[model samples]
Target: MKLAILPGLSLDEDELEITYILASGPGGQNVNKVATAAQLRFNAAGSPALSERIRVRVLELAGTRATRDGEIVITGRRFRSQQRNREDVIERLAELLREAAHRPAFRVATRPGRAARQRRLDGKAHRSGVKKNRKVRADD
Candidate 1:
């Protein structure tokens, strides 16, 4: 069950480790008795399918969801059924991978223009004048 994450990237099913855990939610009698939540773990660092750059980005995008061991852990407990929860986790993983696939636009370094700098200084001077005027003159 390979997952097609982005246009050119796909992840093999073997790359994912999925487990079912008991969910803490209202699901009648089945909630306490059955494990319906799905926990999906993926090794982003060790994944052969991901390029080095994408792997690093994936780890960065994962934030707290990523463990120190470079594993991405995602939990899905929205649904009462294990199948649905599993699908939900998989969907979340795909969405995350898709986000990692896109490269950010490079930011061109810029400096404040002379006119803009002059305007800022002018505003500061005007503010200083207003504040100075607000003070009662000792001579007056």
Candidate 2:
């Protein structure tokens, strides 16, 4: 199965290693007996589906979830069912990849307009005038 992230990027199911583990918290007795949590490991750094630029962004965005080996480990235990958890992890991974695929618009450096600079200077002058007025006159 291929997971489509962006228009050009798709990840093969083989690239993902998913395992089931026992989930902690809030499942009562069922939590101990059942391994419902899904752990997904994806080698983002080594994936052929990603270009160098997208790979770097994905790893950076993964933050602490990414290992030094360039594998991104995502644990999904939000749902009680193994299938739901599996789906959750896959969706999360897709979201991460989608975000990384986006390129931010280049920001052009801009200077303040003449009117804006004048307004700022006028405000400063007004403030200076107010402070000057606060001082007591020697003649008074």
- Candidate with top lDDT is 2
Residue-level lDDT tens digits of model 2 in 28-128: 99999999999999999899999999999999999999999999999999999999999999999999999999999999999999999999999999999
User: What is the lDDT for 18 in model 1?
Assistant: 97
Query: Cα deviation of 51 in candidate 2 (Å)?
Result: 1.3
lDDT (C-alpha, whole model) for all candidates: 0.95, 0.97
* TM-score of candidate 2 against the unseen true structure: 0.90
Residue 96 lDDT in model 1? Answer: 95
Model 1 CA lDDT for position 133: 94
Q: In candidate 1, which residue ranges exceed 4 Å CA deviation? A: 67-69, 138-140
